[model samples]
Target: MKTIAIYGDSISTGTHGEGGYEAMLKSSLSLERVYNFAVGSSGLTRKTPVGMLEVLDKNPVPKDAELFLIWHGSNDWYWGSGMEEFSHGVKEAVDRLRAAAPTAELVWVTPIYRFECPDGMAQAGEAYELPNKNGYTMLDYYEELEHSSKRLGFPLIDMRRLCGIHRDNANLYLEDRVHPNRAGYQRIGAVLDREIQRFCIY
Candidate 1:
């Protein structure tokens, strides 16, 4: 029973703020509380008005929060923010979270594979092959996440690599290649549960 705080974009908001993996995790475990600070179209970059920094600024982290799940960054890739700006935003967000929740452990969940196809099985395109307007692929954004996790000294739950949701099986997990439907959310919830619970071992 941990009081977890979640931060992310539309996926974290979860079908009108009550339908994503956060809900699945809460219901499945019957956890006491979950503070969702996610907003639609949010990202680590400052380009978006509802960016992580903005959300953090608006919602102060509770002192009693035990775990902070900083799940974000997809919109940055989709909106075509450069890697350097994205990385800077991540660092700033992490620093602010650390300042707000000194005792809470932080986890970074990287963005998963995405295609434009919505609500169905993916076609033949790979996520990495599709670049945004700036010609930077989702892989670029994901790599930045890896670097930030290591540099910031936090665990990274790399969905792109580990979530089992990819071009081949996205139909089962994602709603629009961008957000997870019920099944997709559950899949992510299970992965998150397994990953975060490992922290209790020590």
Candidate 2:
């Protein structure tokens, strides 16, 4: 079986339900070697330095693994990290993955739009001039990750565009407005499966 290592936060990890992209990918592809290495509230620049180190050391992807899917930045952006640090941390993670699995194909996933809520609105209200302290916009992180992937030669599947289709008319996301529900995750998995097939033979 072709192995796949998926690294990301709660969205990809399926913390809310057993319905994230990782689970869907396995079911769609009928592959059993897929590893879900995502953690809730995990940021590329984590509070604990050893957090990433521990993950890397424990689940180093083998050289022959078919692919590595990286779905990061939601938590980092949510934690109020700037572009520079976010970009750097993503690069570091990619670099470390390459070092661990030199021959593996790498697929990067960008963060999507988050819904605005009263609590977030209230946070922005503290500043008076600025509103929506959550700063959850589709435009914020897409281009950043796109350009970075171009520079680094990694294939990226833009989650914004995929999620955008249902974003306007439907509640694709859960109550938190961050994590996607089962239907949302299935949509995401379908997109990734198509893109990865085109990019990789497996």
Candidate 3:
């Protein structure tokens, strides 16, 4: 029985009765223990010093963890964080995780597609531009995460591409255009189970 630690935002925390992807993965893999260090509305970078990295530093994961899964960046993009800050925060978080769990296999999961709604669109208006204009879209974050994963020697799971959430399938998977619904969580869990099996040969 292997121990897995999940670190991320709302997607990993889940909403209401869904229990998120972590719970689903636990059941699917039949693991002995699963630790969730995810928080709602959290991101890699923040204006103040209370972000994911800070949280992780304050409350480190168990050293017995065999796998460390990180899924972040959506809130960072929504909050207009710069790419450099995002990258730095990720590096810090990864370093902390590695130091805490030296033998753990690290995996980074990219952000998924978020649907644009009328309220958010109205807030943005016609002239409102993206926060990180250079790396605006979720895909840009995904690319950056992929690059970081390669540089840090961590395997990456491209959730955006693997989940296939788009304009057409937004209603089917997403609950509020940003977070996944129960069905969506199930789909993501299935894919993650397969990926974990392929990556870890326990």
- Which numbered prediction scores highest in lDDT against the true structure? 1
Give per-model TM-scores. Answer: 0.88, 0.79, 0.87
Arranged by lDDT, best first: 1, 3, 2
Model 3, 149-197: lDDT tens per residue? 8887788887778987776788888887778888888888887998887
* Candidate 3: Cα lDDT at 156: 83
Pick the winner on lDDT between candidates 1 and 3. 1
Tens digit per residue, CA lDDT, model 2, 1-202? 3688877777776666466677678877777787777777775665423234347766665666678888876555455555676667668878888887787889888776565432334432111122224553335556678878888889888876765534454465553556677766767778887888878765
- Ranked candidates, highest TM-score first: 1, 3, 2
lDDT of 1 by residue, 43-125 (tens): 77777657888777777777777788888877776666778888898898888888887878888988887775211223324
Minimum summed lDDT over a 10-residue window in model 3 is located at 119-128
Between 1 and 2, whose TM-score is larger? 1
Q: lDDT (0-100) at residue 172 of candidate 1?
A: 77
Question: How accurate locally, in lDDT, is each candidate?
Answer: 0.76, 0.65, 0.74
**Ten residues in sequence with the least summed lDDT for candidate 1:** 117-126
Candidate 2, clashing residue pairs? none
